[model samples]
Target chain A: MILVAALPQQDILRLLSAQSHPAIYAQASNFSVADSEAILSISHESSFWKRELHFQQLTQAARNAGSYEIGWDGYDAPKPSDDSINQGIALLNKIKEAGLSPSSVLPSADGGIGISFRGQNGRRALLEISNDGSASYAIYGKGHPRLVGEFSPTAANLAVVFNRLSENL
Target chain B: MKPTVQHLSKAPIVEAIIAFALEKPLTDSDAVFEQFYALIQSDYPSRNPVKMAQLTVSDQGSSGETQIVGARFASADGKRVCLVDQSNFICSRLAPYETWESLKSEFERLWKIYSPLCNSRIARVGVRYINKIFLPEGEDMSLTVRTRPEIAEGLPQSMFNFLVRLGVKIPDPQGVLMITEAQLPTERPGFVTAVLDHDLQFRINPESTDVWSLLDKARELKNDYFFASLSEDVIKEYL
Candidate 1:
């Protein structure tokens, strides 16, 4: 359903450049180097059962969300911009290295991407990264209390959150 | 299967290639060819030579058909050839193949001459060897060809001929080895000729000078993978 028709390489670049996110545009003046390196790192040498590669493929499928008129969900959702996808993949690489994979990697309504981790007792931690290179996380459960804040999307910080989520589960 | 071998006395290698893909067409390609011809013209005398392709004729007779390769230089026997153009430099030794060392030595010898003639901006380099083994009719194909195509159920269970290709990436040096296994057309009435082609290629720095080591290592990997993909019985037969 997430518009899987692949886009040409040049078209993808054109789409990225056409994005109106001024803050994200200012942060990343170019996507060529980042796109090539990040995509190659995940795809260069890989095998089945490699946890990190799943997210990378998902990111590609999300990036090619241009064939259909997406965002008909009424939220006027646009595909995650290049910055958001890059950060999301980097974060996923770290998490996957620690043997933690997200339940789903989906485009956010805010032109970003959300990686969700669901644990026992309704404990769920959703990490959302926006196109402006900003990341926020929300952890809540039915019986467990809520923990929410602007989290640094790094491996060390992810481990701290995973520790707390594992305890509640 | 024996996973390794130093050198097989009866290495079924049909064709061995030391191929270089240039980043772009050479400047003044016509003049560049003249410069290269001066160096290799003695060893490889013929110009624009044709390599023979073995074809299974409809009458069951086998014939060697000539395929016109553009701007090719060949030895008198036509077994050795250097096919050159604006964007490619492909040196090949057909059938009765020799050692990998000989091929690399020949490449290095000519590469020296060609490199100086044109500023070689190699985009990719490959060490490819194609081995052919003939199995008697009704023999189990898997004995010589270990790779098989997997088809889901309810599909046609029988196939006339098939080819399987596997791409393996080497992470350390950032290279790719593509292995192709196929049933080739043959003249032998009661035998099936199978082709096992292992092509190990990698993108290299255009200015990198240590290409010989890269090629040597790639051939090692290709040889390893080639033997690993065969059955033990086939190795014994070829040995």
Candidate 2:
């Protein structure tokens, strides 16, 4: 749980300012403290998958480690791969094993995905969206599929996202 | 196993790696991923006046009704493809809706704050659905009102009005702005080139007076290249 809470933008800046690393700080320094903090806050709230958290932590760790190559991936949690294709596969696998009814995972001509699943009732759930190498998802729902909304990259937000999506089902 | 788009696109070196990986003579799956990565990392120009920072709405366990923004840039003939992701509540690179009303109000409010921050002359500004756009007359820029249901484009009208006030000429007679669901594939460099080329083309043609003025203004802005992905080195490499 890489402290997925959203700190105030000012606080994020203040923390970054105190960091020992200069290059990472400089790269991130341009963002207003408010923006940085908000993104972090959202990450914590969203339950980001592990890789997203690692990406966030990698910057701080690089600064802390005094090397740009260092990556702070929080492997503590069962974080999924950051690769979109792999994540898509992982998601499909999870849905399949969860004993949920048969669903179709359609690939878009544009390299995106369309997931169609049927609930115990006659309702249908469709998740059609894309990604940006970050934790961003746009979900729309119809019938009684349970959840509908968007998910964006932050720190530790995937768990929350999974719960929000499947808990009700 | 190769580098992910996020890994390569982040600043502080890796540009050369990206360029190297994406260079021509692409082969097999490895080459295909490289090509795809390049497309994902390409810089596409966004004419929308509303920055992501201003439009973000909070989601606090509410019904969470919001539209997602999506953008795809390509050549006029549709060649290279660049796909850009939208910030959750942040800047929208894609037109959320096909109508002008959706964006008019938000654009208006954002214009109030962003206009001073910009010195660029406005090109044709308004709700753009693919190549098509809905624009208002010169006088409409001032009289425009911001309302919830009015922004069919899901953009603020003020932002559109501000650009028109700054000198952007919206295309009229309607044919110039065509909207469709066709996804255009474009790489980052291709996208930037398209925008620059489109603006320059407009300037050379006398029929593009309004758009010309806006291009001139943008050129004079403090950071013309802020949104561009290719540096001089990258351009030189390709040339």
Candidate 3:
């Protein structure tokens, strides 16, 4: 058995939350340390697990960066602000409350986080939350014109968007 | 609603699987040999079986040395099997899945044989189902409404290849379900093979919780996702 250093409790919590994208508590979840490490490894193959592997890599990279800052896609991207992470967490909670799962939760290049949803009907929706508590959305469906708008990250508004996406699911 | 025989299908959608986890790494592979052999010998009498090994290779491309670390036991028919290591326990049905009930029963039987030998408890449990949907010959992939339009659109005219994965928390049964749909590589003319994989998983204290309940929940989620993923017309035609 390969013995990797056990992550700290707080760090584990943060990593789990980031990996699950809905702020999942560590106590309520059963996750393999090996699987987590595999996800973080750059050598791992990408498949259906790609979104999760990327999230784990982001979390580890953020931890290595120190001070809860996330590197947005390895570029010289803006460091995610604490406020942005919190807002992203809040948005994730809202997404879950609406019974919707985003395809991925990724840190944006502009000190924010973005959640994406794809439908089987060629519809796609993205919800991006910035550090300033502002949010914007863009939705596109096959044959139909793309819809772009801004909305507060409230449960009701997120539900409306989630419902639209679910229609295509 | 239970799917009928015509809809349920003997030609299973799932191709293969390896679903299990370990609480702690096993130190001795020989500790459970007697029980393991006794349990599997009935189904798999073959003398030659693959064993898991640890290998060390030099960066200079020299021959690598292998050391046995674990073992995998397979049924004579090769349909059912179990893989065991210090901390991990995985069992899989390679192909032609009979039913969830059979798989669950087999898992339970194998776990019964394994639970006594391993000292550590089960920390996590995950059930993954891989479904392969073979499109009819000459059928336009776009014309099939089995999946949501967002996932079906924007395909190359000659070869349509795409992958969509989503992870959602199951509020009722208390777990996470990861759904993935992708186009598979195929050589058959005018045929497209799409795979819809559902991985329903949860972390739990194996000692306190009932494994059967979790398996039931996983099956429920699988059924829900399967039917929900397809259009009524498609379900009627191919389910």
Candidate 4:
């Protein structure tokens, strides 16, 4: 015999509030269930959607990953250093200041951080920030040739990347 | 072909604004303010100081606001003025439209005075032109007739009012030029005002030293977008 039980509404609300992913909160807003069990079940899959991550959450994740151990493929990876994590946080703040959001934030193999953006119009771009404070970016679209370049972490250089990303946004 | 206007009795320009962003926020805005006051006080002796609150609203429906202190320096006629904020600079010219060259020259003049007080580089420069085109009364004054036919063909006949916005990339892909057009009803029964606003903007290297050249490029892009978006007849009638 199988048994079924429902969780309390208060617990569901708590679980939803604790979610750092923006899309999870957005999805939970429409959750019609009056039970906690259902909410908990769906919360497990919140991070599955890459686009659910918000800019603020990305910054927090980058900061928390200062000593991240997991690699991109679950293998050994270079953990982010304190300086690299700080630079990553600053880069995320600059991205928000430029009115942009990243699609994903991942720790790079070289103890750096990678911010990726997937445009609605099939354009894809990435910005890699090294621990030494150097930045490089690449942009590619369907009909255009790939654009790749390296730049310093100055406001001007960031503006160039921001401007291009804004077009896709 | 060079675009020229044969003097419309009533110019269509509603407002003209030129703004620039600094590479960094001024550490001591008060000192810069005093220097700006000393420079503009000669011509714009009358002043009406102003304060602004910058607000940022999160996607999750949260609000954050911060106070931004600034002042407005105006000419005796109140037609010309410069607004200086912590990191942003703006010069505006209202009705009785001055020619583009005159407005540009005035803004450049003010920029010269204000730039010296700041120890930051130029990050971005922008120029905006807002125009209100009034349609003639008792005629087939449809937007289709006033604007380029290509732009109007996409709309349905049942649509009474609409707003269309587009961002076009410049030749160098270094900037974005935005064009916004709206059809609004006027107090007069048969008259409607077509609001056309254009903004040309570009970001530059922080080490850039030639601010005027960027402004000039912005002006040229603004003109290009203005002419390309409207039909020649519309420009001749009201520009």
Candidate 5:
């Protein structure tokens, strides 16, 4: 319940003038662009484009990881499902956005993805994105402590875990 | 003091949309549609399903299918439209561009009605403005077009027709300003028209219910890019 701004009411004069003026208060229009051959046929490229490329890379990696054969690991591990890959990307985006670099984003034998984080004091953390897009995380080192719980990326409730991983054990 | 944008005699907007994504999609499609139709029936009476054709190849021969991707709820006048799907709820106005104030007011009014029904937070908010610069026959496009050459990513060879798209970063709010420009064909020969579309958007905390500021900022940015895309001589035509 915060006040973003105090927006002024539309002036009475402008409202009256809008009825008769050809130049009304409307913003610019571009509806026909979608149908234009020039807009739909082609697009320009930029060598320095990286902002969108980051997410595209994540999605692509997840897709590639999901393509592994079931017996590729020499065990009876199943391939990660589409849902798990999507959830894995969600977790990857969170940690990437948190400014922490992960050691690797690997697919787990349990048909999910694990994001391994290496922190200071040689501490380690692992976030497992399950097949249903839910998460389970573990922090290893110093008796392993009490670092076992489900993580919800939607809630962004990973602050404590993220801090612990970035700091000392 | 509040700054005002000069009303152009010819506003170039083809479609302006304010889009919102729900935190979690409403799973009950039929119920959601019935409830939403009930809410918007007064303002947007006509309902039409938006479908996308899909071609599927399986063990059997390829089969073409149509998927109900989304739906559009339009007003009786056909000027205003509301587009809704599982996760997105968008309010749009087509041509005969009106003021931003009217659009904002309508969005707020509809959002209030649709919010409780969503049972989810607004995950993302975005505003898109599409402006097409129209030039009648014999009018020179060089006057309006900028000097900076935009390269099309498609075919390396010289192009007979192309569209330029650029995603500019907004450092302040951490969003992408997707600007799309393309020259369009005209019904009448030699008449030139180009479209400049600006869409400003960013992800936000679902809990952050205060969205008017973002919407207002998008409008401001839209206006800024719209005017900047044109040269002084061409802008004079709009003024």
Candidate 6:
């Protein structure tokens, strides 16, 4: 997980308030770890989009000059002033050059673009890149066996959501 | 051999060529074309059966011509049957089969089979727009019904596999499984209960059937969810 002070507290707080990740919590609540594990067992069973998105992130980071930081929702404070939308666009542009087209980005109404990437070990990372370069990072994820309360975006305090996501890697 | 007594008189097929000149009117040309083709290729008795190759579209926006060619013959019990082939493509709409003797014979044969479907034992069989039918002239007539299931060839794999797996044992061993969209459980209560009652089961994900595992995690968990028959209320509730 890439954690950094690039993002401001206001931006993260705004996303949380707006319910930027509306469907994630309920889905997580209903999801079973056993299914995720089973999916991870067969490489071919995973989505091409998931694999492609991860490949672009890893490969682009190699080409670009930026430090990757891991932020946990429980541990970190909201960015001083949230500006994830522009940051997300920049990340997306960088990855597009590397050949990636995200099906959809979250915080769509706001400037923030939530970039989701499937991680190793069946974990996932939601990259809430601020619209500006000033604050852009990733949120690693973790959850309980059933994934019930573990990775719910709604349940997490702003910092916990960000920090917990950073722990995905 | 006694000359077969002709009991039926020649029903001169009253024909009319309603051409749409200036006015844009919705005519039964397409319907007439379809019925005529069915009468010739499938339901009508003919000395020779012909299959449609392609339909030629005229410069006019709505005008086209159908091409018919292939033919085959079969013999049984001192009687001969000629079979014509037809495809269920949209292009088959252009051709009109107009040979009266063959058309009448095929119509008579088809009516015999079609009449039975309306009976109590048959329940309800819909009148599908079939592009082809095989009608043999003279004696020994048979009308066959064709229905394609979801798993039939040419169907999308996502749809095919999902539908085919319903009410059947999954190739892999598993617990009771209900494979369908969660909406309107009351609408399809019988289907849902049958699946729940089944010994082996796997559900096709509602979001995307291709991603078979997407909902697998959500579905297999134990929950006291209600299993009611499908109804309008269930439809409204889900929507």
Which candidate should be chosen as best, given DockQ against the real structure? 2
Per residue, candidate 1 scores C-alpha lDDT tens digits across A1-169 of 0111111122122222221132332344334554323222222221111222364455454455322244745767776777777677667666654555477777777767788887655688888887677788888878778888787774455777655545543
lDDT tens readout by residue for model 1, B1-239: 43776467888887788888777667787788877888788998867533335566677776766653236777865567777766667787876788888888888787778877768677778777877776665554544556656556667544445555555566657876656565543325666656677777777898897787888888877877877877777788777
Q: Tell me the DockQ of each model, to 2 decimals.
A: 0.01, 0.02, 0.01, 0.01, 0.01, 0.01
For residue B115, give model 6's deviation from the true position in Å. Answer: 46
Give the distance in Å from residue A7's predicted Cα in candidate 2 to where it truly belongs: 44
Docking class of 5: incorrect
How do all the candidates rank in terms of TM-score, highest first? 5, 1, 3, 4, 2, 6
Best candidate, TM-score: 5
* Ten contiguous residues with the weakest lDDT in model 5 chain B: B155-164
Comparing 1 with 3 on TM-score, the higher-scoring candidate is 1
lDDT of 5 by residue, B1-239 (tens): 23235668888787777888777777776677779889889988878786667888998889998988666787865668887777777887877789899988898888888777777787777788877675444433345565223444463423233345555667767666666665443322444555676767766798796688988887887777676667766677777
TM-score, second chain, candidate 3: 0.75
Chain A TM-score vs. truth, each candidate: 0.57, 0.33, 0.53, 0.60, 0.57, 0.28
Model 4, global lDDT: 0.61
Instruction: Give the poorly placed runs of model 5, Cα more than 4 Å off.
Output: A1-169, B1-5, B58-60, B135-142, B147-160, B187-190
Candidate 6 on A88-167: residue-level lDDT in tens?
A: 44455454433333334544222334566554355555544443433344433455232212222222134543444434
Count of clashing pairs, candidate 5: 13
Over A1-169, each residue of candidate 5 has an lDDT whose tens digit, in order, gives 1111111211222322222222311222432332232211111111011122344454456667778878668898778887887777766666655655566677888767777766544577888877766778887766546467776756656787677665633
Better lDDT candidate (3, 5): 5
User: How close is each model in CA RMSD to the real structure?
Assistant: 26.8, 23.4, 21.2, 25.4, 24.1, 29.4
lDDT per residue as tens, model 2, B1-239: 11112212222210000000011111243333333334433332211121123243556533433442323333221222232222111112221122223233333333333233322233222121112111222223112211111334555443211111011222322211111111111112212111110111111222353532343343222012221322333333322
TM-score of model 5 (first chain only)? 0.57
What is the DockQ (computed on Cα atoms) for candidate 5? 0.01
Candidate 1 local lDDT, residue B53? 50
Candidate 4 lDDT over residue span B154-238, tens digit each: 4542333445554455655376555556554332345555667776666678887777777777776666656555565566776
